[model samples]
Target: MSKTILITGASRGIGAATARLAGARGWAVGVNYAGNAEAAAATVKAVEAAGGKAIAIKGDVAEEADVIAMFDATEAAFGKLDGVVVNAGILDVAAQLADMPVERLRKVFDVNILGAALTAREAARRLSTGRGGNGGSVVVVSSAAARLGGADERIDYALSKGAMDTMAIGMSKELGPEGIRVNSIRPGLIVTDIHASGGQPERANTLGGGTPLRRAGTAEEVGEAIVWLLDDASSYVTGALLDVTGGR
Candidate 1:
C-alpha cells in the first residue's frame, strides 16, 4: 500500500520539494498551504505527474481549527496518514532583538512553535499505536539557526526552531514506545523562496559563501533527507537531528 503523508507549508520551498520526492517514492501526499492555492495545486500536479496520489489542502497552521480541518481533509482523501512533515514556518525581516516589536515575536512563535505543537498533537492522536492507530513517523523541519542562534538577525525565528528541536527530542521518547517515531532536520542555508519572504532574496548565497561547502544547499537536497527519516530505512532512528547544511 502507498503510504500517506501530510506536509505543511508544502506550497513551495523545502516543503514542496519533500512532497514531490515523497510522491515519487509512491507515497500519497497531502500538500498543505497557508494561502497560495496556485502553488499548492502545482505541488499536487507534480505529485500526480510523479505517479503518486495527492491532494491540495489549505489551512493556517497557527489556527487550531484550520489545523484540525487539514488533518480531517487528509484522512478523507488518503484514509490514513503514515507520516507528517512539520515544515510550515516563517521569519520576518532581519532585526535585532531590542529593535523587534512584541507583536512580531508573538506572530513568529504562534506560527512556528504553537503551530507545530498543535500539528504534532494531532499526529500523535492519529498515529500512535497505543491510541489504536497504526505506527507512523514525523519529521520536523528545524533550522541551523536553532544551534547557531539567530542573534541580531532573527532571534525569534531561531527560538521557535529551538522549541521544535526540544519537542522532537521529548516527543520521540514519549512516542517511540507507542510505535511512532519523531525526528528533525535542521537545514542550513537552502536556496528557497523563504529567503525572499524574509526580505533577503540573496541570503542563501551570502550565508553559504561563509560555509565550508562554499555553496548554498538546494530544496531537493533537504527533501531527500526528510524522506529518509519518514521511511523504514531509518526505522531505528528516532529523536535524531539530521543536518542538511553541507557540513556547515
Candidate 2:
C-alpha cells in the first residue's frame, strides 16, 4: 500500500515540488496552504496528475488551531499520515539586524520557528507509535543561512532557520524511541519565489555562480532529498541535517 504524507505550504516552491514527487511515487498527499487557495488547488491537480491521491487544505501554520485543523483534515481525508514535511516558512525584505524592526523579527520567528514547532508537534502526536499511531517520518525545511548566517541581510531569517535545525536535532532524540524518525533539510540558494518575497527576486541566480556547482538548485532537487528522508529507503537515517546546497 502507498504511504500518506502532509506537506505544509505545499501551494508552491519546494513544498509543491515535494508534493508532486511524492505523488509520482504513489503516495497520498495533503497539500496545505495558508491563504492561496488557487495555488493550493493547482497543487492538488498537479499531485493527481502525477498519479497519487491529493487534497488541498487551507490553514495558517502560525495559528495553533489552524495547524491542528490541517492535520485533522489530512487524517480525515487519507485515514492516517505516514509522514509530514514542516515546510511552511516566511521571509521579509532583506535588512541588517539594526535596520529590522521588532515587529519584523516577531513575524519572522512567529511563522518560521513557532509555526514549525507547532506543525512538528502535531506530527509527533500523530506519527508516534506511543500515541497509538504508526511509526513515520518528519522533515523540517531549514536553510543554509543557519550555518553561513545571512550576514549583511536577513540575519533574522537566518536565526529562525537555525532554530529549526536545533528543533530537528532535539526532536530526533525525543521521538526516536516512539518509532518516529525526524530529520532536517538545509537548502542553499535555489530559485524560488521566497526570494522575491524577501525583496531579492534575483538572489538565487545572482549567487549561483559562487557555489561549487556554479548553478542554483531547483525545487525538484530539494524535493528529491526530502522524499528520500521520508521514504523507507532511509529507515536508518534520523537526526540528520541534510544539505541540498550543491556544495556551497
Candidate 3:
C-alpha cells in the first residue's frame, strides 16, 4: 500500500508545494489547512490530477482537539499513516526584542513552537500504536533565522524556530527507541507568503545577498528537500537538521 502522509498548512507556500511533490510520489496525502476550504480543495484536486489520492482537512495544529480530529479523519480515509510534515506556523509582529509586544511573542511561540510539538506528539502516539509498533518520521519546517540572528522584526520568529530545532533534536533521540525518526528543515529566504506575514520583504533581499547562493529560494525547492527527507531515499538519515537555505 502507498504511504499516507499528513501535512499542515497545505493551503499555500511550502506546504502546498509539499502536497504536490509528495502526491506525485504516490503518497496518499492529508492536506491540513487552518481555514481556506477553497485552497485546500484545490490542493486535493491537484493531487488527484497527479494520480495520487488526497483529502483536505481543516484543523489548527496548536489545538489538540483539532489535531486529533485531523488524525482520525486521515486514518479513516487512508487506513494508515506513514509520516507527517509539521508545516503550519506563523510569525508574530516584527519588532526589536526590547520593543516587541508580549502578546506577539507569546502568539508565535504558541503556534510555531507548541504547534509543532502537539502535532509531532500525536503522530508519534498513533504510529507507535500501529502494526509491529513501527513508527513513522516527522519532518518539521523551521527557519534559517534560527541560526542567523536578525534584528529586524525577527526576535520572536527566530526564537520560536530555535525552539523547534532543539525539539527535533530531542525528539529524534527520544522517538528513535520507538523506530521513529524526527528531523527539521531550516529553510532560507523563500519567496512565500511568510515574508508578508512577517512584515519584512526587505529581509529577503538582504538574506539573498548574504547567502552563498545569492538568491531567494522557491517553495518548490524547499518542498523537494522536505519530501526527500521523508522518502526512503533518506532512510539512513534521522535527527538531522537539513538546511535548504541558499546558504545564508
Candidate 4:
C-alpha cells in the first residue's frame, strides 16, 4: 500500500508546501487546517491534481478534542498513517519579557508548544497501538530562534520552539523502541508569514545575508526537507534535528 501522511496547519506556507510535495510523490495526504476551511479544500484539490489522494481536515491543534478528531478523520481518510508533519505552530507577540503580557505568553505555549506536543502525542498513541510494528515517522516543526534565541523580539516564540526541539529528541528515544521515529526541522530565515507575524519582516533579509548561503530560504525548501525526513530514503535517521537554515 502507498504510505499515508498527515500534516497539521497545512492551509498555507511550509505545511501547505509539504502537503503538496508529499502528495506529488504519491503519498495520500491529510491536509489539516485550524481556521481556514476554504484554503484546506484548495490544498486537498491541489494534492489530488498532483495525482495523489487527499482529504481536508479542520482542527485546532491546541485543542485536545480537535486534535483527536483530526487524527480520527485522518486515519479514516488515508488508512494507516505512515507519517505526520507537526507544523501547526504559532508565533508570539513581539516584545521583551519585561513588556510582554502573561496572556500572550500563555497563548504562545498553548499553540506552539502544546500543539506540537498534542500532535506528537497522537502519533505516539497510534504508534503504540501495535507494539514492535513498523510504525510511522514524525517531523516536528521548530525554529532556528530556538538556538539563536530571538529574544527582545520573540522570546516566547523561541521558548515554544525550543520546547519542541527538546521534546522531539526525548520522544524519539522513547518511541524508537516501538519502531516510531521522531525528528524536528529547525528553519532559519524562511520567507514565511511566520516572520512577519513575529514582528520581524526584516528577519528574512537579515538572517539571509548573514547565513552562509546568503539567501532567504523558501517554504518549498523546508517542505522538501520534511518530506525526505519522513521517507524510506532517510531510514536509519532518528532523533535528529535537521537544519534547513541555509547553513546559518
Candidate 5:
C-alpha cells in the first residue's frame, strides 16, 4: 500500500530531500512551500520521477487558515495521510539576543513556534486514531542549536527549537495511546540554503570541520533520519530526538 505524507517547507533543503526519499519508497507526497512555487513544483516533479506521486501546496505555516488548508489539500489530493514532516522554519541573520530587534524575534517565533504548533495540532486532528483516523507519525525538524544554546550567535533560534523539542516529546506522550507517534530531528551544520538565509552562506563548511566527523552533514543525511522515524521500521520509537549532527 502506498502511504501519503505532507512535508512543509519541502521546496528545498532537508524537506526536499525527505520528499524525494519518501517518493522513492512509493509514498504519495504533499510538498508544501510558503512562497516558492517554482521550487515546490520542482520538488513535486522530482518525487514523481522517483516513482511516487506528489503535489505542490502553497501556504504559509504561520497562518492558521493556510496550515489547515495545506492538510485539507493534501488529503484531498492523496487521501489520508500516514505521516507529516513539520519542516517549516525560519532564521534571521546571526546576531546575539541583545542586538536582535523585537520584530526579528517575533518573526522567528511566529514561524518556528506558532507555525509548528499549528501543523502538529492539525496532524493530531487528522492522524489520531481516537479522532476517527488511522494512526501515523509526525516528525519535527528541530535543530542542534537547541542543545548548544546558540551562545554568541542567534539564541532566539535555539530557543525556538528547544520549544520544538518539548512539543515533540509532549505530543508523543499525549498521543501515544491514541496511536500517533511524534519525534524530532536535530540537524547540525547541514549544507543548506538556510545558512545563506541566516547571512552565513559558508556557515556549515566553516563550522563542520570542528565536528568529530570532520565535516558538515548533508540534507540527505538528515532526511534519512526523518524518513526512518516516519516509517514502520521505527514503530517502537516516539518522543525521541534523533540528532543528524555528525557527532557535533
Candidate 6:
C-alpha cells in the first residue's frame, strides 16, 4: 500500500512543494490549507498529475478543534497515515522587538509554537506503538531564524521556531521507543511566497548575496529534505535539526 502523509500549510511554498514531491514518490497526500481553497485544490491536482492520490483539507493549525478535525479528515480520506509535516506557520512584517505589537507576538506564538505542539500531540497519540499505531515519522518545518534570532527582523517568529527546535529534541527521546520519530528542519532564505506575506517580496533575493552559497534556496530544496526525514532512509535519525540553509 502507498504511504499516506499530511502536510499542513500545503497551499503554497515549502508545504506545497513537499506535497508535490511526496506525491511523485508515490505517497498519498493530504494537503491542508488555512484559507486558500483554490490553492489547495491546485496542489491536489498537481499531486494527482504526479500519479498519486491526494485530498485537500481546510483547517487553521492555530485552532485546536481545527487541528483535531484535520487529522481525522486525513485518516478518513486515506485510511491510514504514515507520516506528517508540520509546515503551517506565519510571520508579520519586519520590525524590532520593541516596535512589535503584543497581538503580533501572540499570533505568531499561537500558530507557530502552539499549533505545532498540538499537531505533534495528536500525531503521537495516533502513531505511537503504545497507542496501537504501526509506527510513523513527523517532520517539523522550522527556520534558521530559530538559531540566528532574526535580530531586528522578526524576533517573534524566531522565538517561535526556537520553541519548535526544542520540542523536536525533547519529543524525539520521549517518542523514540514508542515507534515514532520526531525531527525538525530549519530552512534558510528559501525563495517562497512567505517572504511576500512578510511584507518583503524580494527579501530572499536581497539577502541571497550575503550567504556563503551566494543565493537563496528554493522551496523544492527544503521540500526534498522534509520528505527525506519522513522516509526510512533516515530511520536512524531522530531528534535531529536538519538545516536546509545555504551555509548562512
lDDT tens digits by residue: candidate 1, 1-248:
47999999999999999999998988999999999999999999999998888999999999999999999999998887899999999999999999999999999999999999999999998899988777889999999999999998999999999999999999999999999999999999999999999999999998898888999999999999999999989899999999999888
Residue 109's lDDT within candidate 6 is 95
Cα lDDT, model 3, residue 208: 78
The runs of at least 3 residues in candidate 1 whose Cα sits more than 4 Å from the true structure, single-residue gaps closed, are none
**Residue 81 error, candidate 5, Å:** 0.7
Steric overlap count per candidate: 0, 0, 1, 0, 0, 0
RMSD to the true structure for each prediction, in A, is: 0.8, 0.7, 1.8, 1.6, 0.6, 0.9
* lDDT per model vs. reference: 0.94, 0.95, 0.85, 0.87, 0.95, 0.92
Tens digits of lDDT, candidate 4, 104-151: 988989989889898899888876536533497899999888998976
Q: What digit string (tens of lDDT, one per residue) describes model 6 on residues 68-134?
A: 8988998998876889899999999999999998899999999999999999888888788888876
The C-alpha stretches of model 4 lying farther than 4 A from their native spots are 129-134
Q: Model 2 residue 3 lDDT?
A: 91
lDDT of candidate model 4 versus the reference: 0.87
Tens-digit per-residue lDDT, 134-229, candidate 2: 889999999999999998889999999999999999999999999999999999999999899888999999999899999999999999999999
Cα-based lDDT at residue 3, candidate 3:
78
Model 6 quality (TM-score): 0.98
Residue 242 in candidate 4, Cα distance off native in Å: 1.1
Q: Is candidate 1 or candidate 3 better by lDDT?
A: 1
